[model samples]
Target: MNYFQIWGIGFILTLSLSLSAQQVPDTGYVAHWNHPPYAMGEGPVVGVDGAHNNFHKLNAGFRAFGNVAEAGGFRVVSVDESFTEESLSDLDILVIANPLHASNLGNWQLPCPSAFTAFEIKAVDRWVKNGGRLILIADHMPFGGAAYDLGMNFGIEWENGFASIESGGFGDLFTDHFAPFTNADSINSIRTFTGSAMSSNRADVYPIIILSEGTLNLPTIAWNFDSLNTAKPLAGYYQGCWTRAEKGIVVCLGEAAGLTSQLVGPEEYPVGISTPRVGGNLGFIQDMLISLAPENDDFMEALGWLRYREKTTKVGDIPFRFQVIDWQRQPDGHIMLSGEIIGSAVSFEENEEDYFVVEVGPMESDDPNYDDRFSRWRQVSEFTFSREPIVYPD
Candidate 1:
């Protein structure tokens, strides 16, 4: 346990130092998209969108999804400020879920409803192109209509309707096995409930979850009528899609409920990811988050133990001995790192034998030939590794 604690010590040194000096900056903060005129603040926090229609972080309606993100090492923040380069500069990701303009929320009908203005959309475009991630959740009818314009900028066309199955039972909307976008066998099970459909035609854009063959989108003035009601048909589209641009990534989900956990009434019937009937939503969302924010590393719990031995190394004529330990594999299949400094020369060989090597210490100069200035010992402060386990030696 002590060793594990020490393992994270390097990662938090700067944070600890800042806290000790009380120099916390409000910038570089996580912000959940919220503007009262366009969004609601039913919760105590002004930026929190607690309205039944919105999915702000502080909203009771979105607690399940919020908790899952927090559990995964992300702090859910509320953003009230308008979208601008300076305002959005601090954020790594911006989430807009089931948003509605102030006037539209009164009746919740959509002839024309803009969740975000043209300027705001341009600002978001600039932000994403500068390496910021965006998550847009537009569920059914009005919500989809509201976010449709912004989706178009990313090459997404949202079908403003309710996604359902052609065979048409209540259970038709409940997908037990959603299709995976890639060839990977990581298919997920989920209940979409009532949501919109989307499609994108950009090279960088890819589908993450596909609604089944029988699925269709049903148009409505409002999401009022039952599945049996006469509605316009919108067939063959994606339930979720993501885009990977040169600088950043964008993920869009048609159904917000699939990622959420909530009760319908006082009876407290489970909905979304919380229901036993629908599972693996957490893994699906986590994968999306990882794709959007590749810089955020997953912490692996250490297993087993090893002993270290001293070995001699040549820094020109000077002989230096350092402790080198046998590599131990972590549960995630990467080699566990020891609290020792090993230079670039031995690093590759170690990785070749271990498949993946975790190295912790200060960075060295890029020059192959070491200089006296670069030879000085710098303490291990942080350890960063590839998102996927390394296969080939490099």
Candidate 2:
């Protein structure tokens, strides 16, 4: 699909500090998916943090983030309360984007305190250790400083500064940097606006977006680069990384705009995923979310019920059964449900929503006229099974 057709063709070559203030969510932007992993509202629940004075919320800056997750078949909802055991109990994944301390609200400078309290940090740490995934994003100086404590608890050392390449404040991150996560053949590049950099000494932590030769300028005030600022080379730092936290996982991004689709300035110039340069960002987001989501056991349980029915039922006084001998996932993210009934094999591609019969013949035979032979069983049945008992119609 052509992203330009949806995002339009107004790209901003450079994003200045002045233009950053004018940025807003692109309300028209919609995340398109060729194959959603689950049925609508059937996937894992994702909570977008709205408390702690976050700069990105569901109805505002991170609107595109929620849309992307929803398009990928996850249920997205806003989290309006602080981090706690009870508050995070129901969430499969927690996304905290550019959260800020109340003291730093509208005033980005030195003395940027932690957005999360000691109790909140401990709660989050325990929650992740108990199997709650987290996506922590902090951008630039103040944001990095704000999320420092929460990030540090997970082994990430946030540099509270602006990361800039030789080109400018924004640059394209290539596939080489996404090692152990994605490959060059899968994705070409991802564009990121001016953001911060981070590092982790933990061996378990895998680098996602590593910075090339660049400078990290630590200014006392946000975006105020002067001689007074302490500048350091950002050669080995990371813009994004991920690691496992006991039973759960943590994905830390030093930048926020890369996950967002927003318009900048009066001209409405595109930035982040909306820009033409970052066409692969949507795919990246989908892959990341799939990794964060728990295994799809609901589909497997539903299939188990069918297997049980096959083993117990009979047709016309003759023992009738269809057993799923083998199954595998296709390249398009659909499952190939392969089964045998009365020594004849049938195979079909299925998503969580429904099953589609594609072929039917002998186990190792290839028949061109198989479609004609199994015309009546083109579709097996829609899987409406849940934890409750199945009721049959008389």
Candidate 3:
């Protein structure tokens, strides 16, 4: 097998804001559990399956991310069954770690195997299309191979091999492995320890973590790191990409240890996201999660609160019902609402209005009740008001 490249540069986000100390609520809605054959363990592992046998929370597994998500007001729960509409409906995010459905040979394998069924893949795809978020973490050869099929549904293509750089020197085991995030200062470096690469040409996709130009995705006919004879390096493939679905979001990363915290063997060499010397992997992942779904807290707060349409609503006298999509309190003590407008096709003239004006139409549905209630849902970006909404905490 020969390696290939993913061309083009991505539009990197240049802005960096001070991280907010504002706390979000733990909604107990995160489904971190995996339906086995996948690499995600329920609790902990104590044995090896091929090259990955360790089961401790601090190893290459996703336990560290689970812990972080838990601390950041998310309820991390393990999943063991196949993904379905009803099963995934209530969750905010579903994480699929490196899964290996077949036996893991300790030797370097060229192509890993699939852990997910066809039905499961379709279910996940539909779930994301219907307002569900998915986070996929696939590692080196075998892990990449296992996830290849599932990722294809989202317009992602995995290289199904090991990706590294010539600068790292192919001889060293751990010391020579590292990957860097492009145009991001907060989470600048990745301590890559044998991971794969991925790319997407879909219009809905955007690169988040990009390997540098010199990065190479080397084909592995077998897990033969000792022999580089058949290896052909492909340059500049995307290591991570985020896609915006019809109503949901999908985050895919080529490497796993970038967001992991683990000790390697008895010597206890740190080689994960939690390593003190590691770059912005931890912070970068946290920021990505926050950016993806910060509205969970707002949704929870507004669950039962009701405000009069007159007092709580209207963008320039359009009389639209308020639906909070994004509510954030900036570090400067300013609270902002970038949400949706319901029940109206509203627009505003710039000269006469004090705030930015945007045109949005009504929602469409066959049900009279639903159509009347939510049919006119249009986005309202950066819409600020003098009075606070009912859901705002004092």
Candidate of highest lDDT: 2
Clashes of each: 0, 0, 17
Instruction: Identify the runs in model 2 with alpha carbons over 4 angstroms from their true place.
Output: 1-20, 166-175, 182-185, 296-394
Error of 2 at 43 (Å): 0.6
Q: C-alpha displacement of 370 in model 2, angstroms?
A: 49
lDDT of 2 by residue, 1-394 (tens): 1111111111121443332478888767889876687888999999999998888888898999899888888999999998889999999999999999999877888989999999999999999998888999998879999999999999999998887654235443222353333211234445566778899998767777667666778888886676336788777888888887767778898777778888888998877788876656777787677656767322232343344455465644556444343344444444444444442232223212122222221222366433221121222334331222222221
Q: Candidate 2, after superposition: displacement of residue 64 in Å? A: 1.0
Compared with the true structure, the alpha-carbon lDDT of candidate 1 equals: 0.49
* Candidate 1 residue-wise lDDT, 143-201, digit = tens: 78778888998899887766654423222432222212221122233345556688877
Q: What is the lDDT of every predicted structure here?
A: 0.49, 0.67, 0.49
Using lDDT as the yardstick, the better of models 1 and 2 is 2
Error of 2 at 392 (Å): 31
Rank order by TM-score, top first?
Answer: 2, 1, 3
Model 1 TM-score is 0.58
In candidate 2 the C-alpha lDDT for residue 382 amounts to 41
In candidate 1, list every pair of residues with a backbone clash.
none
